[model samples]
Target: MNAQTLSVPAAIRARRTVRHYRPDPVPAELLDELLDLATQAPSAWNMQDRSIVVVSSETGRKALSEAAFGQPQPLEAPVVLVFVAETAAWEAANTDISAQATGSGAWNEQFTAMFESRAEFHSLRDRGLIRENAVKNAMIAATYVMLAATSLGLASAPMNGWDPELVKQAIGIADRDDLAITVMVTIGYTDAPPPHPGRRPRERTVHTELYAG
Candidate 1:
């Protein structure tokens, strides 16, 4: 943990969409710890169907910024984490997932067998559904990385606007159709930042038992 680590709530409160950044390089050891914590984000069936490409080189950052429609955040931040959704990862790792689940007693062998064979499970295995779930997993992991960055006395900015095709080509995955670029998060230090924009009212966004319009 960083010496100046903040609590979860404080981190959330302190986080903002920072674009400009100081040129100081983020320590590799700190970045590794941040990723170790980021990847701890939960995934569907613990499939962990996501991969991150850390862009630190000047050329890589320039390419990513171009992919992100010339967004300055990617171009300026010391590091940009490209979150990728590996749609085919789950298909090839089911056996391993089931074995681990059963091994850990999280799922019994018989239940794992039945779960894989059930019609309900089959319904969720379509290509589109699988892709959507994979992207969701990637987004969760990105959020974890962003929050982790803030907690570690670092700044981050999540960039959602980008050309996926361009991103794939930028990151050297143009040939892999099974992988999708879900999101990008820039991590670095900032000198000055504007105030948090603040969130919408809880009553307007959150709802109990049943959602109310």
Candidate 2:
């Protein structure tokens, strides 16, 4: 329940990317729970503007593999979750609240009127602070999902090596600009041993007083 009480070290050690799976399906309930756990991640102003597209079908996996530079692991894993950072949702919420307080029901319409287009909506993404928060929120949510999967005895890999626009288009989402792909996570059991070789020694990665002090 509390950060201090969490046994994260054990979870960190157990969590790994398993490329080989036994073709077993992840239970729907467990998948739902894992997604719920991911939302527990903190977001800017509690916006929580993140969405997930679960790709479980063979066709979906094939498309994802293509989007991910033809990586075969997406096809091997039972599930591939595409984490999306929804900037439009946050923009719409802020616009609605501002309009309600100012007694204007047609807020976005008014914005379109002034800009002579839908340019104002795109302005929301131009703001560096909002963009930064959007990315941070999405990444934190993905971390939660990975940790939850580990706790559930499932292996996962957080991926960012993909074409965002292509992946968004492949997923068939209408609002392409609004939702930006942040990461992908493959979930399943592993046949190979955990690849613990890549990790840095604890002493090298951690510090006590100060680095080079």
lDDT of 2 by residue, 1-213 (tens): 122222467777777766667688888877887788887787754556787888999998888888889987788899999888886666453544344534655346564354334353356556655555677788998898888888776778887888877788768874576677888899877766466767667887788888851
Expressed as tens digits, the lDDT of each residue in 27-86 for candidate 1 is 988999999998889997777889999999999999999998888988789999999999
Clashing pairs in 1: none
User: Which 10 consecutive positions of candidate 1 have the poorest summed lDDT?
Assistant: 118-127
Per-candidate local distance difference test: 0.87, 0.74
Choose the strongest candidate by lDDT: 1
- Stretches off by above 4 angstroms in model 1 are 114-121
Worst 10 residues of 2 by lDDT: 112-121
Candidate 2's displacement at residue 80, Å, is: 0.7
lDDT of 2: 0.74
